[model samples]
Target: MAKVAVLGAGSWGTALSIVLADNQHEVRLWTHRTEQAKKINQTRRNDQYLDAVIPEAITAYSDLKQAIAGVTAVVFVVPTKAIREVARQVDPLISPETTIIHASKGIEPVTLKRVSQMIGEELTAFKEEEIVVLSGPSHAEEVALRQPTTVTVSSVDPDRARLTQDLFINESFRVYTSPDVLGIELGGALKNIIALGAGISDGLGYGDNAKAALMTRGLAEIARLGTSLGANPLSFLGLPGVGDLIVTCTSVHSRNWRAGNLLGKGNKLEDVLEQMGMVVEGVRTVKAAYQFAKEQQVEMPITEGIYQVLFEGKQPKDVVGQLMSRNKRQEMDDLAQLLMERYSQ
Candidate 1:
């Protein structure tokens, strides 16, 4: 057991805190909101975000310094938009040897950088071996209740990846390690876009065939962009990519999917966001993905369609029709061509 600091009191943060405490590790959770910290400390519960279960061994702190002090590792579970801010606040307090793991999944909209890169930019004092990313199909709601889950922790250093794997792996929550940090992080971030597309399909009352098609094609777009950015293409077929997509796109727990569902049902994006009350990552990700696709010259029809619906007032039904009416192509055409090019290299 190790002393761990969870720098965020959101649903995912609380869920991860529960896991740490359940595994008999001492966990100090940090939040900017004093009232929220007080509530968690006094009642051992996080009602607004994760109301199902709370671990007694976990404590909440409003002071970032106190939360980060003397911890063996820091696990970041904050919103992607706030990661840099939080990193700035926590850097001075982090020990040089402390292992860092981030569970948040989303790219920085303005920077178009993954959370790990943002963390690196903020914490210039830490070496690359000290950072890792933990992501996969696990959702905070399900994990907080101790339901079975699995996730991946990827870092450039294989030893560091294994250490991360050991930290979170349990009978109920499994962990896998990978050295493909860029690929894993990129896959995790981009899958949310596809989940949004999946939600749109659901909202349109489209059948499983439609949803499956969105998921499959959406992955191709994700892989294409990631590979263009120097990420390993094979990582797309692994847990952080396809496995996470299956859960996010198909599961009701995904906020991105839910947001898309509302859009498909004729609700405006603004209205859906207002109703969610929490961060809907896919909305933020759409603009970043759009910019990334254009910059990388990647073809992402599903993402493009969703972007139009959200920003250009395109009808979701019309977008669906446009997709179905596109030029016919072979099933393995893209994959085979991509592999052939790789072999030529």
Candidate 2:
């Protein structure tokens, strides 16, 4: 078993640490809050983040250097906005041989950078090849209880990608590997926008037909942007893409969809955010994605409509009407065009 360092004491981080510990791997779980670290280390519980008993094999620490001093891999489970700061703190403690698997999803608001790019900016020692992204439909709440969940581990390097798959796969949890790091990362980040749209539809009392269309067309937009930036088109249909989108959009566990539901119910954005008490990634991601699409000249009507409703105060009903009235074209025209262009290169 490998000695793994799980940075961040959030629910996802705590959940992943438990999984590694249950797999007989030594885990050094680090948290920014000393109280959280002390609580986990002493009581074997993280009451604030996860409502479950922590594993005995998992050791918790507040210090960055000591937590990562001699570990085989470092798993980043921090919030998307805090990724760069957390990576900066852990950079000095890492070695070239150590594998870094980042699990945070969502793009940075200011830089509009993917989490992997943020990590790249923070860590100067390794290239993008050294990084791996762990993402899929698995939620922290269910995973903490060891419920059956499947996820994907994506990297530019084939060996590193497969190694991550082997590290996390088990009977209750399955792992798949992919070389489309960009597609995996992009899909994981972008799907939250569609989930927000899905939630809005739910809030509006729209039926499954509307939600299904939003997801299908929403995925096409994501594929368009991803392919423009060197991602595999097929990856959008896989775990980190469609799989992640389905769960996030439909599950009541999704904070993004829930927030959008409230917005559709006519609650102000600030009020909804204050009530949740947790970060809702889709709200932030919509702004970044909308801007990215414009800058890249990629057509993303669904994302554009969602952005207007969230930030520009467009009525949810009006946005829906606009989407339904748009010009229709062949379902696979854009995808086919992008794929053929990619293949010719």
Candidate 2 on 47-158: residue-level lDDT in tens? 8777878888899999888899889999998888889898888788788889989998999876888888889889878777679999999888899988999998988888
Misplaced by over 4 Å in model 1 are 127-129, 336-345
lDDT of 1 at 127: 62
Question: Which pairs of residues collide in candidate 1?
Answer: none
> What is the C-alpha local distance difference test score of each model?
0.87, 0.89
Give one clash count per candidate, in the order shown.
0, 0
Indicate the TM-score of model 1: 0.96
TM-score of 2: 0.95
Candidate 1 per-residue lDDT over residues 221-257, each given as its tens digit = 8887888888777788888999999999998889899
Strongest candidate by TM-score:
1
